[model samples]
Target: MNLHTWVAARGGIAHREDAREWGYSPSRVRAAIRAGEVQRIRAKWIATSEAPPELRAAAAASGRLTCVSLARRRRWWIPEGASSTVHLQVGGNAHRHSSQAVLHWSDPLVDLGPRSLTTSIEDALAHLARCFRFEEAMMIWESAITRESLDIESLRSVQWRDESSRALARSVRGRSDSGLETVFVVRLRGFGVPIRQQVRLAGHDVDAVIGSHLVIQIDGFAHHSTAADRGRDVAHDAELRMRGYTVLRFTYAQIMHDWDGVERTVSSAVARGLHLPPTERRR
Candidate 1:
């Protein structure tokens, strides 16, 4: 591939050495730079104009993207109302380069070369454990586990540097089908009721089942948007109800924007023994 295509293919930025390794000579790189096909950052990095702003910012700051910034790039589920601050990992002795960026000074979980513009998944999760609250961190961790097909046992084996990280490694079951489900499970853990996720009932997997009968279905922003999808969900709910399941359906807005109301509704259901089996409830 040509220089511009190659650079753009690599997320619109690349190390000069990587370009050379890809068979572009120094003169050719210089020519590309002069022709405005690529721009050099510091002396070692070159970027096309279409490079993501967060990556370009990291290159400019001589740091690697980490924490929520990298999580967002990797499409991990970030909690609603989480900070949008650009998070970067820099050397401990590095001076403040940008007031807008939140700098992480911890040593990386893995060694990254100077040319690397982003932290490894391990390092990003380690940083996230420290940067976000426990529930928020768990959301991203569970999303990463599901998206990456990460082995939970292997994650537990890593020598995580913080108690939060270790706790998360222990707590994460990698069972959440989506970040929304993770949020629901983590937040409801305090209720002391047994909750099973992705339970197969009525030939469909419900989001969660509390006790033996109460079923929880969480709808993401795009979930059930289509009429057909909504119809299928309605039919499934009806089938579940006919089978003696108490179905509690929640939307993204109800779960994220108005969690208090959601919590109240759930707590009310549990308080009235709605989560119990019919025979147990009668007792």
Candidate 2:
């Protein structure tokens, strides 16, 4: 591949070694930079002018994007209120830069080979497991599985150094359709709430069922924007409530932007005994 194509394919930035591996000679690489075809991120990294800002920053920092930084780019669920610092992975023997980025100085479980701008999904998950809290890591991992970005079975076979990472791999399930649902499940779990994801009820697949009667539906913008979709969701929720089940619906905006409000709403329902099964409510 040509230098421009190779750099663009790797998300806009690449290491000199990766560029060389792509059949671009050192002189050609230098010429590209001098001719404004590419911008040098550091002594060893270069980016096309059209490359993404984050990838260029990662290259400038002398690291490949990984952990939460990579996960955010991949649309995986990240922790609420997490820092927006670029997370990068560098080789164990590589010289570290002093950029204001989070760096993981470890050997990746799976090498990127010629792909150096970002870590592979497997390596990102491994780093995520080590760096983030259990709930956050599990949410991201579950989101990855939900999107089929990585196969769960293949991930299962990979060894984990951190106990939390191992737990995350074991806990990931493919039923949750969105990162919102993943966060919701993990958050509810902390409250000792018994919840089942993607529960089939009344001919519709609800996002989650708590206790035995409370149903939760998570709507992302991509799925529930149209008037007909909103109308159908309202009808379904009404039907569920009419069937003696309490229903709670949250939207992408509410979950990601107003999580405190979301938590309060759910917590109030639980406090009012709305989440309990009929038998449990009586007790």
Best by TM-score: 1
The sequence of per-residue lDDT tens digits that candidate 1 reaches over residues 123-186 is 9999999988898899999999988889999999999988999999999999998888999999
Q: Give the alpha carbon lDDT tens digit for every residue of 1-283 in model 2.
A: 5678777887677788777876898999999888888888768888888888778776666568899888889888776687898888887544465567878887777787634778878888888888887877787788777664677788888887778778888888767777678878877777887889898888889999988888988887566367987788889889888888999888878887888999999888888788876557745
Give the distance in Å from residue 215's predicted Cα in candidate 2 to where it truly belongs. 1.4
After superposing candidate 2 on the true structure, give the runs of residues whose Cα lies further than 4 Å from its correct spot.
Answer: 1-11, 14-25, 41-44, 190-193, 219-224, 250-283
Lowest summed lDDT window (length 10), candidate 1: 91-100
Pairs in clash, predicted candidate 2: none
Model 1 TM-score? 0.92
TM-score of each: 0.92, 0.78
In angstroms, the error of model 2 at 50 is 2.9
